[model samples]
Target chain A: MDRNIARLRNRLDGLGVSLRPHLKTAKSVEVARCVMNSPEGPAMVSTLKEAEQFAAAGVRDIIYAVGITPAKLARVAQLLEGGVDLAVILDTVEQARAVAEVSRQTGVRIPALIEIDCDGHRSGVRPTNQVQLVEIGQALAAGAELRGVLTHAGDSYRGGGAEALQHCAEVERLAVVDAARILQHAGLPCPVVSVGSTPTAHHATDLMGVTEVRAGVFVFFDLVMAGIGVCQVDDIALSVLATVIGHQREKGWIVTDGGWMALSRDRGTSKQTVDQGYGLVCDVNGTPYPDIIVADANQEHGILAARAGSNARLPDLAVGDRVRLLPNHACATAAQHGSYNVVRGSSHVVEAHWTRFGGW
Target chain B: MDRNIARLRNRLDGLGVSLRPHLKTAKSVEVARCVMNSPEGPAMVSTLKEAEQFAAAGVRDIIYAVGITPAKLARVAQLLEGGVDLAVILDTVEQARAVAEVSRQTGVRIPALIEIDCDGHRSGVRPTNQVQLVEIGQALAAGAELRGVLTHAGDSYRGGGAEALQHCAEVERLAVVDAARILQHAGLPCPVVSVGSTPTAHHATDLMGVTEVRAGVFVFFDLVMAGIGVCQVDDIALSVLATVIGHQREKGWIVTDGGWMALSRDRGTSKQTVDQGYGLVCDVNGTPYPDIIVADANQEHGILAARAGSNARLPDLAVGDRVRLLPNHACATAAQHGSYNVVRGSSHVVEAHWTRFGGW
Candidate 1:
């Protein structure tokens, strides 16, 4: 995790852009402290629950990255009034109007960013849709502080080589930068220009117009990121510790207590070139077993078997033997457990237990 | 939920078999109390966490339905010593030996059940493998109390008409009954004969020789169950309330705050005759929008769109408008939440808040 944090930190530092790590993946204050620029944070979160929890933990600068609803602005105002520089993201004029109304009503300057769509992956206004973008910006500037623009290269997870990732990074940069430029032209203050996704943050070659890069899953990279060439399999920092309960020797399956409840239902890698079924199976020491994966899972039982058509012999894992399953997606899998039993690379000695918070 | 409970209760009562409602779905004590045969339950659970939590709430009789490991026996022994009749299921002789060893050491007489594989869906010993079945039973009888046999027709989720479900139910029943007879032939006592799966429990035409039936997820019927003809769409008792935040009108997408984080990644209905994408989108009043579904989702965004190939027009849902999403799998979706805002049929007034417990 330290190495992953350092890798991105150094990369963004070289590009002359600050790294505002997204805390949605690791909802631990301890983890946030390690990745944040400071203890107070210039962090990003997906839910207000995260914003509130981090604010209570002394984090002041947070961007609630999801599109905001009018009903949620009261909580946002409360955080602002509590001395936290909490910002929200929105794409519509209706949302902008709501944010502005709440800001005026609460007598708190609510900061917000216009979400820009780069590749039409999910939410946000298209960069070329300058009319709606400016309208939304003008509405926010009326009462709320328009804090520039933001976009996520969500489509970057569709794997290509390094060239495609770099192209995606450039596309993401151009989207937010173009939106910020248009806002400036419309006599709106566009101060912050932000863009990211784990793949883009790692592969981005230039960030000339961007102020900060945001990413969450880099701290605990998973099979999805590895599949997209953003990281190696060994670079993944998260795994679910499981105990072998029994075996189906005739079917060549080893049953473990770690199932979807522990590993999550994210099949993020099924579309990748190599589909790590539910997860990749590893020894207790964090070494990957030969061609073994969680072939199927029930609510509480994971069936570990050799990958299809692989000749690798199933390991003689006895009942009560321990194994670690590397997840397909870090954020989804980590959300399953309450705490992380932190351990350093390859060594099983206990370090610390970091608590994780969840809910919206 | 009351209606769902009564339907199964009435069905099982007619079959003359006791109902051991699995608390794996609604991990709330209040919900458990509503569904259990009695306060001191003859209930089933998938995780020891549920067993421990329910036991703490005065649920005495619980069968940990997952195959047991030697390491978990200590916790089971603790529950048994606490005066809770905590039974565990296993298929292998190694697991049986481990349970027996733990029982002997703790002096708690841990009850054990031999799992029979009714269909080649997941774990359990095949009923025809009587030599191994008797071996496991005898191993349990050595120190642990060999209670009986259990089987789940997990493959019943693969949709067929009611006839197929009845056949699956019969297959599940005969497998456990045959295993119990094998154990009896070996001069071992087989007191309980258990069989279930939500579909099988509902469709079983005959339950002769079966002592008890267990089913979860029926408390909140999901799209998967409805697609399989087990229930109607209106019978679904669980739904995620979401607020519309934005829209991509050109793409006919209504964005909501509820994502996979709220709805879960269990696309259980995808393989059914009718696929309900992430979920079926409904109005605040619980009426589903014509052909509307959660087409795709990000971490905190659900994109609601018309079902593919449908001529249904997108509803003009403004920002802050509320909607409910009926899940694809009740168990998986409910696991994502910390609590349920209980409401009666078609009423928006939250009757009570039921806290849910999770972990293993």
Candidate 2:
């Protein structure tokens, strides 16, 4: 196995659990097949588009990881009926009620994983909100089945250091186990207590109550993850393959075809220790040459230059020369391109097209 | 005309020039038909997918406005041969020579538009690079028809005020006319000197050398333009109609289905005076309130709250209620969805569905 993959696997196994990696970041089925089928029973996804792709590629047991939109319930139910054990995550009783109503009407018998708010802010019900469990469980019992509870330590990225990872794990365990206990005491079956985030899943000392651990981005880590001390730059697998289109020799700038349009306009790691201006510029094989952080990006053109912390000097880059850029965030960067130009050791081997679905 | 349409049209007409709006932003055949059949000739497209769509919709004149990629040359050539007056833009002499070679070998004349870098340090040949110009013109003369010089006052967007508009016009006039004059005086009969951008074309002071205009965002003005003083907030035509899905009452957050995945992660106006966070949150009819700018966005969720600039007092916004979001950049935002739910007048009725195209 690749050292990065082996490192991630060993880390996950040390917690006495298996990693059911999330496929949201790597939207490619070819990539997901590599992750999910690797000693992991199931995986998680942010969109039904991912679900459809992964299912088409023969991954059966999966979880629609994000909060479900009511409009997509029918399609999700269809996926469930197609013998692919699909479970949805919802934080609110209303959403659970909607799912239950649809399930009862169609006799779909779909299972749901109630979402727990590890943090106070984003989506998901607070684990401290004990009454929500009884209420939501009763609502689900009327129409759907309550599988257990799921929580995402999303703010884990904010806690970038090893200490931050431990902090995130503490929050995750408390939230997931607390929510599970609430559901269990409510006379409902809470079998699976799932919690995820690359940092927490990688560093958590115990996975006592957690049945399934969901983590993505470990396969292809990013600058944001590296900045947070979660993974080193070497773990990142993907890069934007771009040609040096032009240059501003006077400004010591190298121009490339990879712009904000190619790398995405996400300043995901900007507030962190290392702000990868656009992204960390590298050779075609993903080796980082310090000087080239694509500094300023317009629509179709990226300006490559040396930022303040850069130690390297790009001595040989010229127009028409090719390079790759390791993105700050994988999901956001991957979403910018319509297809993944998947490379197996540098030859243009295969392309995994992503059909991004969007609607009300 | 509706207030939105009239406001946009009046601005373009006021400038004494018409806009060749990009179907890439609007993506509606009916709207393209209306704009083309109106006073403005066909249009420009940001992508070949859009160019193909418009060509099939009976549009005669079209510019595959972005820099031509080598992989797409065959398709562009095919479109030209299919009787579509597809004018493609090229910046480098290398690009011109390559395209010219393609045109020469195929025995089909593809109208080539030379791109002029008018202060936007992205793509395009520097207007002052004359030795390169003669070589490119000679190459075009050898095979491809040197139709004209094209300059996008792309920087005009950054210059949203009156002075900025004037700056746009000056640059447009100088870059296009000067480049065209250079080729013409060198004995290459370059007739057209095309120039445009919403900021410049909508505020054109003179057209001494410009033959035609290519301004796309004018047809569907965005929050960035609105923030820049080019267009009023009410002039923004298209918006993402999003249904509120969940809420974190304590945090005063209203979650919506229109996530970054739907809106795209292009924070086009984040560096502007009024950073419309994600986008400008508006009512169904396009009227923006001070309460919302879709404060934060994730892949499957858009957190609607008080505008970052305004007081954090959100309205009685609840779950399941729908709201509209005016985009940061019309092009990037429109690229996220498959089609538009085009509304006529102030009515919520779907007058027509605009089919969109994707891929490079």
Candidate 3:
């Protein structure tokens, strides 16, 4: 997992770019420390649990990556009281009004980022919604301080090729930039222009106006990232160490303990070209060995087999033998367990437990 | 959760079938009590954590679902010593030897279930591999007691419909029956012939030679089961209650506090006619709305909108308003959170903390 995170960081740094990594995917406190670099680096969090954990860990700056709920405002206000610099995000005028009202009541000047639609994939205001952004800006300005605009290039997870990813990055940059300008044009103080997603971060060169990038999956890259032309298969770090308990030689099936219970049921690879079955098949060293994929999985059993037509041999594998499996989706795979068994090469190293909070 | 657990038992009573429902999914002491109406109702568990906890809670009979790892054999042996009638599964000759040797060392007469390949989806000895099963059986008979043969119809999850699922179930039954017959022909007593899966259990009309069934997903039915016509959407009980956090008017997106963190990244709906995004959109009271689906999701955010061309006039939902989301896969979604925030209508009833177990 460390290698993948470093590889993405190095790749982006070589292009004179910085990544505002989301700590939500790898919720490990140890990993977050590495990402934040001791002091609070600019990071995106999916929940207040993550924000509170990172903030309490002495990280000063954070962006609650998920859109903020009005009901959660009092909690966000509580977090602000801790003296940590935080930014909440939203897209609608209704959400802005709610945040503004909460800020007025609590006397908490929590900064807010307006989510802008880039790919029409999920949440956010449309790129051409100049009037709505102005309305939201005017509303939030009346109550809370307007931070800036943020957008996630979600579509970058689909298709293939760096050119496609690069195009997505350009579009993502335009969306956030356009939304920020609209807020500024409406007399709202908009400063930060944030865009994120692993592929966009890897391919983005003309981040001239992009202030910060908020990508997450690159930290513990999965098969989805590798298959989408974002990263090489070898770049994946996080893997479930499983033991081959049994096999049916008549029909190629290897049963391992790393089922959905261990690796999660994220079928992100199903849509990719070389559908990594349940997850990308790998050797004990985390290398993707061709033709070996987890074809099916149950709650606590993964059914692996050699792919349709390849000279992939399952000869060396036997009962009690161990193998590391690269996840199809990093976030899902990481969320399955309580902690990360942080390893170094083939050595059984330290185990870092991620204390997860609940009730969003 | 309690109500649904009872519903499963009642459904089984109606079918007049005895099953050893795996407690691995619902690793709760209280839930296990609800299911153990008969002697055979002693649920199978996948982890040693469950075995220890359940055994301590007075559960005598348990089949530790996963193959007994070397490190875990001692734990299983310990549980067996605590007056818990234990049975463990093994698929390979080497695995049988490991369990037998552990049993010999610990003097824990651990019962064994030799896994047979009912469907060539995951683990087990093929029906044609009579030689291997006979070898393992003879070896185990010399060291440990051979209880029976077991097979999980895992392929039933992807078999599509009743006909397809029935075919898969037949394969499971035949594989186990064939293996049992082979052992019987060798003058070995193979008492147990087990077949299981929610699809198989619900649709099986001929459990003629099968002694036991092992279905776990029935208690907390998910959208995946509903997608394949095994269960109706109304049968689902658990849902992730989320508040509308943000919105986009033009793109028609309502952002929710519950993302994949709460809902899980199980996209079993992708193969269906309408991909139910992250989950099936439900009202605040746990009723699925017509054509309302979560279109897309990130780590901690979900986008709720219409399923397809059918325009849905989503309720006047504002930020802070709560909505329940029925998940695509129950086990996956339930695993996302630490515990279930059980509710009865609008009142908060109880919090059933799932005691999860990891490692061998």
Q: For this target, which candidate reaches the highest DockQ against the unseen true structure?
A: 1
Query: Candidate 1 on B141-166: residue-level lDDT in tens?
Result: 88999999999999999969999999
Clashing pairs in 3: A40-A59
lDDT of 1 at B341: 97
lDDT of 2 by residue, A221-269 (tens): 8888888887788777768887776555656777776777678777887
Docking class of 2: acceptable
Per residue, candidate 1 scores C-alpha lDDT tens digits across A119-229 of 988899999999999999999988999988999999998969899999999999999889989999989999999998999999999998999999999999999999988
Candidate 2 stretches greater than 4 Å from native: A1-7, A37-41, A52-60, A69-84, A308-319, A351-360, B1-19, B27-31, B37-42, B47-60, B67-82, B96-110, B125-144, B284-286
Cα lDDT tens digits, model 2, B278-313, are 987777776776757788887778988886556757
Each prediction's fraction of true contacts recovered: 0.77, 0.30, 0.80
Name the runs in model 1 displaced over 4 angstroms: none
| TM-score, candidate number 3 | 0.91
Q: List per-model TM-scores for chain B.
A: 0.99, 0.92, 0.92
- Top lDDT model: 1
Which candidate do you rate higher for lDDT, 2 or 3?
A: 3
Residue A170 accuracy (lDDT) in model 1 = 97
